[model samples]
Target: MTFSAVSPDEIAQPKPELRIGFLLMNHFTLMQVAGLVESLRFAADESFSSRQIFCQWEWMTCDNQPVTASCGLPVSPTAPLDFNQHWDYLVLAGGLLEETRNPPAWLLDAVREIHARNIPIITLCSGAFIVGNAGLLDGKRCAIHFTTRDEFRQRFPKAIPVIDKTYIKDGGIISCPGGTAIDLAADLIRKHCGEMRAEKGLQYLLVDNGKSRSTKKATGEAATLLYDNPAVRKVIDFMRHHLDSPLPLSEVAEFSALTVRQLNQLFIKNTGYTAAVYWRRMRLEHARKLMSDTDSSIHAIATTCGFSDASHLVDWFRKQYGETPGSFRKRRRDVEKLVKP
Candidate 1:
């Protein structure tokens, strides 16, 4: 995700970098459409002039019919779905909740065909609905927009619906909920196109690249990258998402397909801390963040972070930060007051 400004000679040379096939569903989201494709265009050419030099994206459809957007705008397909046609990633601009159930045969077939070729599928907004109904997301971690989390869970019980992550990838499926599409678009550019091209594209879009890093960490993506073991990563992510009520190590271990002892050993190897210790620190860190960012009382913050009471939180907080929660919150308030006009 690092993209420092390179010297003139170090800039990426023009070449065929990324090829993406965009599948526009009925009643698709137009905002996601503009942000994703426009970012890719900025990365594709010099000075915001799009010539598809470094990246190529096409609007496609299954039956060559015009796909109406949620805003009442009808967009004709650029081409029909051709399984033989190669693409780096097949992206879906998703639609409403009702569209998910009993999807049309043509749409389902297109997804199966595209996946059979081993091309990755990127789902934006509710498009995870399409992929999940198409049977492409079984046992995969799919990022769901907060509004659709419950429905996605009921429909696809095997698929893990992650509301915290901005974007996520599981094997061939990549997903982003809502406007997080911008960050996902940036990630795609940086992965296929060179770093220079990604930076230039964001520069034109005026996107702060630093926000992506913080968002990723806030979404538990930092822990996912710490260990290669999929089970360890899953357990850590579960821990982060449940900071309000930390689950037992045994239950989480079972969720990750590892026993309690096995999970602890992997955690020690990957993160240099046992599961109990790491999870405690994660809860304490969350409490600290709440103290600094919000105006909640100590008892409220303690409850949110899974502590029995304010005193329970303070004991652990002092052990970790060398000060009580009250002191930290006071210092942050004082510093902010001093800086404000």
Candidate 2:
């Protein structure tokens, strides 16, 4: 079961094709699975055809049984688990009530065997909990949905939990919070296939904005709340790009091509927040991400997030999160240290 580290030359010339195996948990999220599979499907061919020239995938289970999604959609497995076959990656598509459900004993043993063989493992959504339960996530930083952060911390104290990130790669494991599987798929495509193919796949999916992982989730959630209005969508996109130098209310209104009064009415009618209030919230979200993801100084983060100064950022952060930025970062760092061997 010994495996050599991948050389730089090998990475520079990745294999022309990849085999992917997906293990679906009961009541999995359909969107998460579809997002990842569709990205791979589109990247498998040149433009419109569904040929498997570069990537291949198979839905799998322990006993080749059909699995139902959280939305009550059923999908039949295409194959049973085959350990001897060469698989570039194996992903677990996790379910809704993951805290209550344990993966079957056979499946847990299969994952451990796969890990021993040097095959990379990916955990989407609460599937991370399964791997943590298997002792695979010990001494590794993993991604979990913010809603599950507290439960994950309580359950797997040996695994470092990272919030606000779409996906993280620690050693041979790739972990992501639920609902951002497309980003993870695109990253894999870029790494193995090429930049052109990955960009084309994203463009085909109409996600060309190139947002960071944390910001992408926020924007997606905001779009859902705004009811997909074209004007509001454009305004939000503009605001995201200008976080370090936010526009004034008048300019934002002008940019959206709506009168100031109309903009205010639209914001309140749709999101129950005025344009100014929404803008401030977006800034705060960005600041929180910076504080968690980077080691920038408080002053640097405040300036980057358009706060007046470090004190202003601290004041707003305390009001929103009930803690100063330094305290929050220190707490997270302490938790991370606990995961180290």
Estimate the TM-score for candidate 2: 0.57
* Clash count in backbone of candidate 2: 0
Best-performing candidate as measured by lDDT: 1
lDDT of 2 at 149: 86
lDDT by residue (tens digit), candidate 2, 160-217: 8988666776546777777748777876776555556667777788885546344345
Cα displacement (Å) at residue 10, model 1? 25
lDDT of each: 0.73, 0.72
- Tell me the lDDT of candidate 1: 0.73
Q: Best-fitting candidate, measured by TM-score?
A: 1
Superposed model 2: Cα runs more than 4 Å off = 1-16, 98-100, 210-341
Model 2: how far residue 287 lies from native, Å: 40
- Residue 20, candidate 1: Cα error in Å is 0.4
TM-score of each: 0.60, 0.57
Least accurate 10 contiguous residues by lDDT in model 2: 1-10
